[model samples]
Target chain A: MIWNEEYETMPRADLRALQLERLQETVERVYARVPYYRQKMEEAGVTPADIKGLDDLRRLPFTTKEDLRQNYPFGLFTVPLDRVVRVHASSGTTGKPTVVGYTKRDIRTWAELMSRTLAAAGVRRGDVVQNAYGYGLFTGGLGAHYGAENLGATVVPISGGQTKRQIQIMRDFGSTVLLSTPSYALNIADVMADLGVDPQKDLKLRVGVFGAEPWSENMREEIERRLGIKAIDIYGLSEVIGPGVAAECLEAQNGLHIFEDHFIPEIVDPTTLEPVADGEAGELVFTTITKEAFPVIRYRTKDICRLITEPCVCGRSFVRMPKITGRTDDMLIIRGVNVFPSQVEHVLMGIKGVEPHYQIVVDRQGTMDTMEVQVEVSEAVFSDEIKHLERLAQQIQRDIKDLLGVSCTVRLVEPKSIQRSEGKAKRVIDKRQL
Target chain B: MQLEQIAIFLENKAGRLAEITQILAEHGINIRAMSLADTADFGILRLIVNDTDRACQVLRDAGFTVGRTEVVVVAVPDRPGGLASVLNTLTEAELNVEYMYAFSQKSGDTGLLIFRIEDLDRARSVLQAAGHRLLSGEEVSAL
Candidate 1:
């Protein structure tokens, strides 16, 4: 089932050589085209010619989300507008989004990587692939789409949401491969049960590729049990060329195999920014070796996971990274949407008559992530009539939904109820075991 | 006549109602009549107390979100159709009642009804013109 046996099974020495050659080309290209990366490299007193070996990657400056944000839309893209074919973005810390671009060949590379990802997940030609990742400025949707199509699978470009219809289509289309965020998979299973369509009897699903949000082993078990499919964990970020960067081979299903041929993976101590020993948990950093339009060098991903140098049972020589355990920052993925506490505070601050004091309570209810924003009700917001207070709650809910694109319960409590700390107010209470 | 009623926000937790009542009891505040409007998460307790300012202050100090609202009290005959007749007059006069609660007086054969109306002045004129007996703040508190 290996999509490209030659590259996927390339020996460690050959892969390292390929990575070093691509790394030099990427470093030289960025230096000649992108002023930002060149400035960062110059600041570190390192030139493109300095990168002779894979170990010299650390000599080059590390790129971060802040670098992406400062660059904004296409500041870091090495190619001109005519060469770029597609663009995607993810939520940034503030209002503006972090953007990435891809050339035509970059798109083809993405497809090839995703094809490898799907093949690793046991997807092959003739299998009906129901892609439920959201299709928009977010990369998850179209990323999986082109990959499924490239793998020669019958692609049902059905992007996320419409849970009942998703199950209906899966049952009717004889779909074998499911692609979506893990939480949405649970949602579809729940809807299927409600519709009396037992997955084991009414559907033909065999495997699922779930990603875009961190989930637990227990969640994986629950999804597998309910959907009656082998739940494969896929890992990617918009910054790292979307969901095709890594995937869990169905043979091992233990850790996700990083497509090392396209992207170089490194685990570094988040605090010290030093490389952590192999098999040790630390922050994951990536250098897009084969990417053309937007090639990043040593981009700090902030996602905390370890690297498994041991070869996977699937015979792919790529190193595997386990499921991400935690984040270095306070970013809450509610139902697969990135939410920051400051975003909630921004919404609350815009609305008058309510104190800015708030707490975000995130808990999993029956395999779904539920967020409840608890705000302290000031005297000005309190109304003797229930309708007025209800309207206030609705306003907060609407504003948050409009801004964050996630539905959450807004609870108004007595004044001073949300605890205020001495150093920093504990703004989030994440109850999800993951 | 208009009467001052205090509304307290209550979390839907056990002993919350008792705690509010105990706070009022400790303050020696007499409760004339009360009603509770509840939802799944929280409730609003509306009370016509003997002392509106004192009750609101006590609840506010105890960390309860309290608000003062003006409600109209009407005296209705202690008969089944008497309540219906008052509502009929209100319907004819085009007055909207946000909420209402009733309690029978200790001595008289009449019931005291608290009506939360939007336009209190217009409601007062309409009820008085309809020959309905209205109770003042003092009359309701001393009841």
Candidate 2:
């Protein structure tokens, strides 16, 4: 069922050679086209010519999210605007979004990679894919959409949201493959249970491809048991060209196979920025070699995971990254949306009468992640009328949702209730075990 | 006349009401008439205490979100129709009542009903003109 059998089942030596070649080409492309990369490489005292072997990727400077933000919209893009067939933007640490562009060939490569990802997840040509990932500026929906389309499957393009309709369509459309974040999949399953629609009897879904957020093995088991489908974890960030970067094969389902032909994966110590040994957990890094429009060289992804170089039963020569354990930073992914405590602070600081002190409590209710923002009720904000307090809560909730695009419950607590740390203020208290 | 009511914000958890009661008890502040307005996440405990300033000060010092509300206390009959008659007077006068709570005197025949009227002065005058007795802050606190 491997869509790209030649690349997927290539020998280890051949895969390494291919990765080295792509890496060399990608380094040269960025150095020549992007000034940001050129200046960074010059500062690091390394040129494209220095990337002789794949091991020499460490010689080049690591491109961070800060670099992307510095470049803004199109500064890091290798290809011209006309050459780019598509653009996808994700929420940045600040208010701005990190934008990624894809050339026509880049789009084709993405489709191939995604088709390979779907094929690994057990999706065939005739399989009906109900893509529940959000479409728009966010990469999940359209990324899964084109991939499923390229795989010759009947893509429902039913982007995220609408729970009841998703269940109805799952039954009506005879969809065989479901693509969404793991939490959304669980939410759908819960809705199905409420509607009395048993997935085993009613739906024809055989496989699910979930990504965009970190999920646990227990969560995978829960989804599998409830939905009656093999839940496969797909790993990708918008920076590494969205969801097709890596995915778990149906045979192994142990770890996600990094498509090394297009992108070279690296594990590095977050603090020292030194490369970690294989199978040792560290921050996951990627170098988009085949990406013509947005070729990133040694991009530091804050996601923490280990790389398993052992050959999987799936027969893919590429290394598999085990499920992401934690993050290197304080960034949080609530229901697939990337939210930072600073962003919440940014929203809170703008509003009058609210103190800067706030705590974010992330809890998983059933399969859904519920974020409750507890802000201390200062003397200025505290009102005698319950309606005014309710209105204040609603205002905070609305503003946070408007900024982060994630709905959360805003709870106004008493002043000095949010615990203060000894040295630094601990803003986020994530109650979810995963 | 308007009576100053202490409104304290409390998280909806077990022993939260008890904690507030303990705080009032420690301060020797007698709660005259209190009503708890609650939602799923939080609750607002509105209390007419013997010492308004002391109750608010202690609650604030204890890290509780406390506020002062001006509520009108009206003396009504202890019968069932007592509430309806006072409400009807407000309805006839077109005065809006945000919220209302009651406390009956054990010895006296009249019951004191606390009303969070939109226009406190106007509602007090309307109630007084309707042959209703209004309790002063001192009189309400004494109960």
lDDT of each: 0.90, 0.89
lDDT of 1 by residue, B29-101 (tens): 9999999997777778999999898998899999888988998999999988878988988999899999999
RMSD of 2: 3.1
Work out the iRMS of candidate 1: 1.2
Kindly list the per-residue Cα lDDT of model 1 for residues A67-160, writing each as its tens digit: 9989998999999988998899888877568899999999999999899989989999999999999999989999998998998999998898
Candidate 2 C-alpha lDDT tens digits along A42-95: 999999898899889999999899999999998999988999889999988887
- DockQ for every prediction shown: 0.48, 0.53
True contacts kept of 1: 0.41
TM-score of the first chain in candidate 1 relative to the native first chain: 0.96
True-vs-predicted CA distance for residue B119, candidate 2, Å: 3.4
Error of 1 at B36 (Å): 1.4
